[model samples]
Target: MEHPILFISIILEKLGLPVPHGFVGNGLLEQLCAPYMTYTWLVMVFLFVVSKMTLGNLEMVPGGGQNFWEILIGGLDDFFVENMGREMADALFPMLTTFALYIAVGNLIGLIPGFMSPTSNLNTTLALTIIVWVTHHVIGFRAHGFNYYKHFIGPMWWLIPLMLPIELISNVARLLSLSIRLFGNIMAKETLLGILFMLAGAFFAPLPIMMLGVLVSLVQAMVFVLLAVVYCAQAQEHAH
Candidate 1:
């Protein structure tokens, strides 16, 4: 199938940069300008600008942007604290917040015309999953030192033979689960919207689906973060 031309691709092509006319090819330049990568960069820039605008000015009263950000951040902080005690929450808050914001924005960006969701790509989702997986394991090691390995061993010594492999397999499976779940949902959402747009032809018929897409995007982001929090919290727990 021919790839839909994105506004970014047009701009890049006009600027004399190489951009493949159809689907992303194997070339380095094509991969760099792939729809998902381009939109991902756009989402990152959008978030950066919004963050600066929201956080640049400080006021005693805290109206407008300050009030909005405080409420959002405070709510997220409280949610994390409730899930995993204060210390762990404090340690993981920034990373978790970044995950939530980035995933949420990336997922939602697909609903906009000429944009694609970064989370819809397996590479992007896998990258995020790997980061989360490594982070929790590192936290586990920090929290429990070498004893973190005890987590893989069962309560009794003999059970270690069976339990160790089981634990290892399950942990590894998390990598696949996290990445595939997000990628599948967002990709399906994007596909459905594309079909709807083709059928409806710029009409309001897709509005309902778009609204549901928003809910799906938020729910998926929350689900991903919630699972990450659970994994991190479990890692910090003392081994039986």
Candidate 2:
């Protein structure tokens, strides 16, 4: 049988929805939408239901899924405190939490049958990169006023010409790196699992690949979050 996730994507395409075409062509908007919209909505619904249940009763202690979610959120809350500091992190926590949970859930859900992770799509990753790009600069400008442009001048007025091109290239490269790394990891894992199953024809053969998939999923989420934190830090630095 074909990869169920890929098959679902094919179905979506036939229905005239956007999905990722990879490097092949256009018409692959679902790659972006899957992670950002469909999967995100599912995560949100899950969160809402859980919130209603858990917060419905004021408890000093959490139990079951509520406990698990509380721990997870607490860890993330601590992470924001450590990295983003108090004020900035407080201000940025919503966006950070949303991005982290959305991508993490998307990655984990790909392990389920008939679901492809949207982060595996280059276009989706690129769109995310663009969001990061815009957010960093917007925050920077808001914090530092027009002097945010000075980041490119290398602390010297004479260096503007050279610094501009270098800074531009570096930022552009971040987008390319973000997109390509995610696409390569996900597509390659899917391909490797398929080939392994074909060779062994045994369930055990694919187990190793799935384990690796778990690692890849986690690492990709971390990479994304780390970059976001760095971008936010940069913006905050400029604000100072």
Candidate 3:
């Protein structure tokens, strides 16, 4: 079945706005802008609204929406500090948290009856991978100048001949791997659930798969966030 959200996302592109176009539309700018809509922008809007609504009022003890959001951000902040150090954590926390939340929401969006999870589309995932790749490598080169190339070449002059191509291939593979893994898993899960829903009219029968859907959603989010953390760390790594 053709996903309706994918179509709507395409129509948004037709108006010259940015939206993802996997199988929906075909335009250079549409392709370029699609990821922003499919994942990043959508996620950002959700996060912003949720955060503002949740934490609109600061409280000494916290309750309800404020408490929930505080716990979420606080937990994420702690994770970042443990992984990336206090200063870096403080600096990158917002971006990292935003990325995670976006991917998570994008993944789960498919679970809704009419909407499709944009992350399940290969183009969407690839676009996100490219964004991360560019951002981190740019930061690395900016910080370390020519030394950032060493990440691809490895340590020791002797290893360059053998390791350069290997490392280069690995880096490229990261994009493909990240994109495919997310696209395949989410798409497959949704497909299976879709089939089961069609086959079984009983509500409880599909509940298990829906539960799995939630798991896949969280896992995909974690994978994206984890990769982002690794990229950020590598970009900011001490130069050899």
Output the lDDT of residue 175, model 3: 81
In terms of TM-score, how similar is model 1 to the real structure?
A: 0.93
RMSD (Cα, Å) of candidate 3? 4.1
| Best-to-worst TM-score order | 1, 3, 2
lDDT of each: 0.90, 0.71, 0.76
The residue-by-residue lDDT of candidate 1 on 116-214, one tens digit each, is 898998999999999999999999999999999999997999998999999999999999999999999999998888787777846877789899999
Clashes of each: 0, 6, 2
- Candidate 2: TM-score? 0.79
Better of 1 and 2 by TM-score: 1
- Best-matching candidate per lDDT: 1
Distance from true location, Cα of 79 in model 3, Å: 1.3
Candidate 2 residue-wise lDDT, 60-162, digit = tens: 7666767877888898888878887888888888887877776776676666655656666566677777887788888888888888877766657687788
At residue 239, give the lDDT of candidate 2.
24
Is candidate 2 or 3 superior in lDDT? Answer: 3
